[model samples]
Target: MAASVQGGRIGNLPAEANAFVGRRLELAEIAGLLGAERLVTLTGPGGVGKSRLALRAAHAARAGFPGGAWLVELSELRDPDLLTNTVAQATRLTEQTLRPLLQAVCEHLSGAPVLLVLDTCEHVLDECARIAQELLASVPELRILATSRQPLGVPGEHLLTVAPLPLGERDDAVALFTARAAAAVPSFALTDANRAHVAAVCARLDGIPLALELAAVRLRGFSLHRLLEGLDSRFDLLVSPARPRLARHQTLRTAIGWSHELCTPLERLLWARLSVFTGGWDVEAAEFVCHGGPLDAEEILALLASLTEKSIVTRDDEGAAVRYRMLDTVRSFGAEWLTGLGEAEAVRSRHRDYFRWIARQGEAEWLGPGQRMWAERLTAEHANLRLAIEECMTAREPETALELTGTLWFFWFACGFAEEGRTYLERALRRARAGGGPEHTLAVWAHRLVTVVADDLEAAESVSAAYVWLAEERRLPVPALPLTGASLAVRGESARSAVLYGSVRQAPAGDGGAEFFQLLTLAVQAYLLAGQAAFERCAAVAERLRAECAKRGELWMGAWGDFFVSLAGIGLGHPDEAVLPAREALAAKWRVHDRIGAAAVTDLLVVAQASRGEEELAARLLGISRRLWHAAGLPQLGRPDLSVFHREYERRLRAALGDACFTEAVRKGRELGPDAALALALGDTADAPGP
Candidate 1:
């Protein structure tokens, strides 16, 4: 599923794993500010719970903003240039156009009331401020809740300084400590025997949620009296009364340092090394990236469990897999220690190398039964992949960057990241050329294909010419011949496209070793045949492709096959027979979060419904298709052959329903949310409107 489709909301705010002990008043205030102000920043020192408060407030206010609340995490993002792209991706605005990214983001949000919580903005303050300002000015109903150490300095910004929890006998800090302590040790509780000690520990830690939680977890290894003594000594040595302003900041640092000191040497080594990951990483990634020297791969799981028990690292079981992440404050501490150990570069290199291996593996297996699995795994690793590419560019390893980008073309193309892929490919190509790096043929062709899919024909043609030259020099067959045929078909050259596509089908079995590409070739050929009025040939090819994809357990390419089969059925004057396959294709596309494919299948449904004399349904479906295309950031499929059918069927519907009824139906269809629209399109009578 798309990241935006979290439950029914278009956001990715994580569910709170533990009880929210405090922040009741702050939550109310932040909620009120969000209602009155367009932009609000929760400013405070690190580990004062800014991110947690922001998430709580956003979730509480989610209902008011129908567009859904989204969290845009900036901690893992290092390069300032990717701020906007990161926001766009987090908001799930898959802009498949050449327009400026910020412009597309604004346009996507202009029509809806969205709440965006930008977490960890201090590092990219200027960029965040600029984008926040632009988004606020351009989008009328958009609200942003930012968590930063300092203000964004944007106009109309409301600043809410988050403070640590209050410490007292029955305050939130003690309650939080008690709650966490219970989790750490089931027998622990707030009794007369230990209540005073727990309160003392919270007070000494300044009632900071993170610090208190860290202290509570120490109950697993230390007695209450011993934990209190350890904190007393650590605080006295670390905090100077002369620097009151930095006292809480220093105290939190001291707490984190104390935790570090308590770790075994191997655990400390692993902690520092795991800081190299961006976003959350699974156990497998942790093992591959952090295992070396004193840290053995087999010891990683136990080490991870220990850290989780210590509350230094958190585990998330909400996704398809279990993943772990350090809070930004904790991660920063680990990063500093890693640097202090003089192992930052080596660990980061290993991080990049692991992801590079992952990319190659994903590319090799993407055509098989693991297609969906690879897509989800790679999507989960999106941030790490970007970091790896960024590191390559920073280290002036453009050849590595080029090859990595090339290897991930399937991910970018089939997984709804074509625009992002184009951005990386263009950057890598430019850098490689400037640095005089060898031009990898795969990278060159990958760039051409992504560019074409993103509707940048001019840029794609330029890169295609380069690839053609390179192919001749190397005396090898072009691997992108199917892409060339696709471009030709898009430009109304059906005859030439057919011949090129036929040549690809006739190539040797081991020619490309890319079953995905072969399936795509067949789908494209089916579309071409349909456009040429050869219904039988189109049906046959589409069915064959669909059977192949089904046997391989692939849904993306198979959905395309379903679409073509429906299209050919309608062309063969069997509208009734097209309905089932059209509905099936639409559902499958939506399942894979293929907005573009969903829109295409919805268009086919419109034609199918219209041919069956369901003019009203067709008009409504046309509206839904328009909305889907708008969401996909495209006018249509960008295929002239497909466009011809849509235009013809739409004209017929307009005449049959008349302008007024057609317009009203379309309006209603456009108003439906994703779930409701899909339900209605799938013939769920409950969601169907009255005539």
Candidate 2:
């Protein structure tokens, strides 16, 4: 549910999707607890609105945390081992170092005033508690707000029990029902004629928000009187004889079950199958994974619409695209039914297979006009991809898992997820080796390339010799040759790197997508040229690469091309010519969530400004670049060639401005958020210091 704010920092919290009808008192109390307590847990039964309240509270408290407020949604996450990595990603803490992921996250957060919201932690209670305890112990100014059905049992945890809405005349539950009822049927209202019936229905459902919402959807089909009568009969039939005291959760479950029973047979089938998805999914995904046998593929859209009308599925139409999701409680109910039908594994297989196709398609089309679209699409489906990978691993389909993970190397490497890619690749490689499957040579090389980008040279080298031998034995062209050249450049082997890059560029276009390889080759070649002090040649090659990217309508590689052009211009001592390309690269990189690329360009901007004798502005830009590099988990991308330029520029700026003035300018820049820094770089000058 995280949304990107253009020109600003990425917001980890979900935007309010709809009107919040009630809970003024609970909100006030939570605001107070957050003021005094470091850890506040909102405990309640399922569908009692804990997540909604927590999100609202986090948004209210966001301004207090200069480090930013982040929400780590744990509901879709199945593996307890991934908790730390998931949290780190939510905080935008990339890991390109050899340190443990937790240590990296703690280090990134140390001394920062951050509010971390761990939503839906019941499934990973023990792990969540462990992480929370460690983070609290390490970060002095950090606060945590967690939502779970029960307490996490961590020290210094304050529990706030969230109860069902008070059923008073104008209380939350009735107001919630009325609001949802109006949405269901615009002409519907709480009239004098049906006031008693509305109150009867709310009382029947025990004021649970989810139940009320579901019941409100019935308004489109049934009269208020008939709906009340239906709920009365349904509730009585659903009560368990063993537990005469109908618990609150049981009441909620009965409501969901009643809604399920009312769906058409096809709608019910699709509902159960759709449970295979972890996060929200789109129409294409649902059709692919949920259709078969009794449910025809062509009927999926209509069935999905029916399910949405019945409140079994919720639609998100806020953006340009429409997506759908079920409440966690509703999804759980469908999962139980899915397991009962013995179709869980089959549906999950289809889910995995569908995402596998997505990975393959993304890889196939990565070098074309659809590059930006693929990047955005894959990012949207990231949770589903992770779910599919988990399913493959759970089924012991390591070969398939490796193929899927390997095909997504571009996503992991170019889209700011190299660290996570390394994790999945390592796991798949281990499992594939243990399974005694065919030596997946392509996947092995892909893993090595990702490791190199992640700054794990030792791991990258481990597979180097074997991959080369295998590729030659099988007569397979090394598709990763350009990246191999990049690896050499990172190690300061400019001469050798240039030779490799030249061979890749000169090779005839083969079946290995040579056009893509050539693009990469040119990028690295330009870098090598710049490092070797051939500024004019570097600029010429980079301009050609940028023009190619423009013709192909590609943004990711085009941004890199712009970066190199700017680098060459700065190196050639034409600082004025460097500024536009630097800004262009930063904007494009930010569009694709390429933090490392943006950081690199920001660093280049510093040098360009310094060479133009704008010493104070250069110092400020330097500070901004430092923060960006830290967030990216790499200083100068851990590349010695780039680091050398960074050091030289900083030294020159410091000498020109002297220590005190330079330090003050950098301090001001470091305090600015991503939005401000970007504005300053783009010549807004509003936040610039006076001379």
Candidate 3:
């Protein structure tokens, strides 16, 4: 159910499977399972090359199911709860599923000719089977190729019992091992001297692919006689002549055990501790989280790097960060090793604290607009952030957990992650309320207020009590508490909003909340709503800042100020005065590349241009504005409270245009309000009817 930062693992279908070396008969056998039967279960003992065979056939036949072929690997999954998510991911379904995910799977797959390759289903047989049967029944065009130890038993499932690679003369297994061993260690060839022994070993092992490969690894070091001396005891011996019927089937566990026994002690320790990380870790993270008695951070990093070379960890192709993760088989082996070492919990806690410190550093960088880029860096480590929150709370380190979520507010909002933001904020607030440190409450109130104001007035007021609590506390960061005033204003409590802003103890005029952005927003609201006189006084201070923006060519923010100024001008009925400011808003929008704001400002410009008798341009610009707004996904009217703006447009259009054309324009603008739409469509109302 959780999202992973670990680079995803994709198992390759054997190369010969693609070339389909000597398996034309086998391919036809599997192909028959797909026709008339929606489910084909591939049952085989471990290392019998089941996955390679099934996946290859599915890949070859992918053209028939134009919908696509998807592989859902069940090996890495530790929790059965994750079954649906894994399937969802494999099918490339991005939307959330509330009903059982299996039902969602059917709905998504229904009538879509798709072949799903369900690999390694033995561990989660029941969940996999339930999904397979539902898919087979509901999806007319869906088929499955499942690899498991046992049959799914779902109706219409044709069992294709996969055998190991053929072992006698002209067999694929002996040839593959000989080729791979020669490639892995060049000087030591699989000549006639070792050929006889290798073939005998393959027969004894029932030609299991995994066992053959492991045995091939020893050809460089051990003579055939020496290897045979240790053969029966080693998993590769596979010489169980008396018990050919064992269900153990000379399995994955034996093959993995032989690999684990070869690792040095330090390497083994590193492997075990690395499992404490929920996702793969970067070198620095591995150093700190897995540090131990003899292994310092440097040694841990080196060990991780070394493990990658040995295939214990897979290195990622993405270069933003060099990271490593264990393969499913190796991870299982490492987990067992970790339990024996008895250090899982302590390693997990260290991992949590490492991320907490990262959050603290991130908080300092989030203070200014530079925060935007810093938030991006933090984003790359999101899984670590989530794991830190989860582990810290579970460990009762709520203080650190609260800060972790609190500091990431910028990333939560700016990155189109609002729903995710709400989730973490809720978690942080609860922890802060329970036993988190003092900053928690401030953060909780701030996060809640942002969510409320952005979503709805009902939400803003829902947490009014929290705002009142912060006001009483009056901390320096209580600027967040004062935001309740803005929320209240949105809810029609202008007077209360005024009083709260006025009540804030101001520093000297030039102090300007000493570089806090919240103070700037608060000061802007308080100054403007405090009425015309207060706005004029504050405009002088704003003028000084506007000069700095002009100097930097930061037309965007300058236009933002002009927007508020134009609104003030319109309220005062000084159309002539509003003209330059409204035009400036348009310029600012284009200057900063704010398309949404650009379209909005064009509407305002239409009203201004009409007031100034620019009818030809106003009419054409209105058409452009309408087109832009439609394209921007906001085709409706502007914010609900802009009636005065509409009236301004109507006044200009009526005065400058004739009654006949004005009447037709009025007919068209009628849907949007004859007043605003007329100003938007045909400006210049010198002889127009009164609003």
Candidate 4:
């Protein structure tokens, strides 16, 4: 009933990779389509990963074809004149010139059973149409997988549209984000506090994978509510002309515009208002952030339901119970029009306030599972979270200003989000300090937080005076003592900070904040600056603190606990002993976008690695630390102190290792500071020095 591709052969491939995701059904469907059709064309809106799916499917079904499978990546070839050459390349045909290439491919595959994967052929649809027609007529036993935005205008070509993943199930987009977030931010898991919200965010993303990916990246900086708000206002910021071809395909704003032109006014406003979050938000956030107060709760609910029907907004699988999000594109489109309507500031104010409320809720939850959940939610809303801080600081809303800064502490430190955190916290502190009240306590908190995330300590050190002023002038009877002390210590008052923490520890810490924070002070004093015995003392104290935190179900401070433990391990000259905790700390810190935490722990990890003869790893990590530190405008690590370690590290490490800490910085890695960078450089040398 259908054409048979027999005796066609495909060539060698990259090691059958599994790094790719979500194509099982497509693969199967493609297999079935190939078995049943002469020519099959897979079509999607764009960036549907059609080529990837086709290649994977072809790889998997190659055995069935026996002649093998081949790929013609048509996306690169714009000249129709080069179509034959492109085909020749895909078939691996040698060409003295392009003259004989097409004929040569036709002859070469005459007796072979092969499947040809034609990727991204939409732009040159005519050329593809001609090629497919010619190849099928002459070769008899060839199958093709051609991807185009629209049909290739070829006969016998069956089209398959790859839609976004279904959000009807519980583990659809939310599950995908959960898996991807954990991958990007290791050990990240969906927690009860954010389960509903995360699901809602995923659903609103309309299950578009790339949109989902960008949202996940945002999780490194802000809350879900914060992300939503950005989604509300992003079109205003995201619109810059891209390369014409790319502008349509790559920009979320364009993608949403395509969808938004299909919506009504109220629907568009509803969409913009929904953008007031990074993660899912409650009905309260939506009503306050989106509606102009004239719209009652009931009317708003019905409008939201209407958006879901058009796929403009998606409620989570539990239906109306959860919060909502917009697909990145949808949100972008909504934001564009929201700005165009001159309602940007009015709506954005609502968006900011909603984030403030969410941040306060998140702050209250910082002590429990809520800590992780809200942290992740914030991580997804980095853009909006930042906007909220800017709005509050500019508007001089002291409470909102401080809380937005404080609420993000966990996320900023956990996921290595120090850069963004420092920006907003500084502005917030400036506002809080200018206002001059009990809010000064918050200004101190802001300064301390900014310091930790500041890659460049020099810039942050200027604010050290303010941290001290807060302690001297506004040190609350609250346990914010260690926080202030730790800030001061990091700014260079180590001995005094050690004593400051001692006072907090001495005070009867009846509950949560004091105990958890004071641990930071003691750890800083005993290990960061002290000798071997002091490290042991720090270790003992940290171990006790860790157990106490565990007993109270407070793992929020685990990164800090692990950081101290690794320091003790490194101080003891047992770098190997430091490895596990250091690695764990790095992973945990990254999980929550705690950039400073990751950097601090990595510094210790490098010390341990250098001590243990992992010179190459040390060198790589050292480089990373330096980059991170520089980005934060912080002062450099003691190059003189680190030189000895670097030299020693080179003596032992002849080979660098561990994917060099993410692909973009494979050579330099994102370690901690100059100390770590020196170690990494040493490790990179083939003839490294031995310990």
Q: lDDT of all the models against the reference?
A: 0.80, 0.80, 0.58, 0.58
Error of model 1, residue 245, in angstroms? 9.3
For candidate 4, lDDT tens digit of each residue in 1-691? 0011223223543333225566567778988999988788888766455666677777777886655567775543434756775575445332222124456567645555678888878778888899889898888888877877788877788999877665644655676667666655665678887787777666556566666655665555566666555654544355446622234254444335544544566766677666645445556667777767445555688888877665567676443347676654455566677787787888778788777766667655555544556666664454466557667876745767776675565455444444345556666666565655545555455546544422335544444444445444434243434444444545565555544444443323332233445555544454444443677777876776566555544545766677778777777777777778767666655545444444556667667866776655566566565444333323333223434644444444434433433233324353222323333333444433345
TM-scores of the candidates are 0.91, 0.91, 0.58, 0.48
lDDT of 1 at 234: 77
Instruction: Tell me the number of clashing residue pairs for each predicted model.
Output: 0, 0, 13, 81
Question: Model 3: residues >4 Å from true position, as ranges?
Answer: 1-163, 186-193, 201-206, 214-230, 233-251, 358-457, 460-691
TM-score rank order: 2, 1, 3, 4
Model 2 — TM-score against the truth? 0.91
lDDT of 4 at 241: 65
TM-score for model 4? Answer: 0.48
Off by over 4 Å in 4: 1-284, 291-305, 314-347, 393-417, 425-435, 452-475, 478-517, 528-535, 551-557, 570-577, 603-640, 655-691
Candidate 1 local lDDT, 1-691, one digit each (tens):
1234456656667787777778899999998898898999999998899988888888889978877688899998887878888887787666454568788788777666889899999999999999999999998999999999999999899999999998987998999999989988999989988889989999998888888888888999999999999988877775568864347888899899999999999989999998989888999999999999988999999999999888889988878899999988898899999999999999999899999999989877766677778888998888899989888777755789887888888888777787788788888888777532234666777777666752445654555565565456445454444555666666666677645455333323322234555676688788778878999999998998898888767788888888988989999899999999999998887765677888889988888888888888888888888776766656666643445655776678779888898889887777566677888899985757554
Considering only N, C-alpha and C atoms within 3 Å, which residue pairs clash in candidate 2? none
lDDT of 3 by residue, 617-640 (tens): 454455445434433333322234
Relative to the unseen true structure, what is the C-alpha lDDT of residue 645 in candidate 4, on a scale of 0 to 100? 48
Q: Pull out the clashing pairs in model 1.
A: none
Candidate 1 whole-model C-alpha lDDT, 0 to 1: 0.80
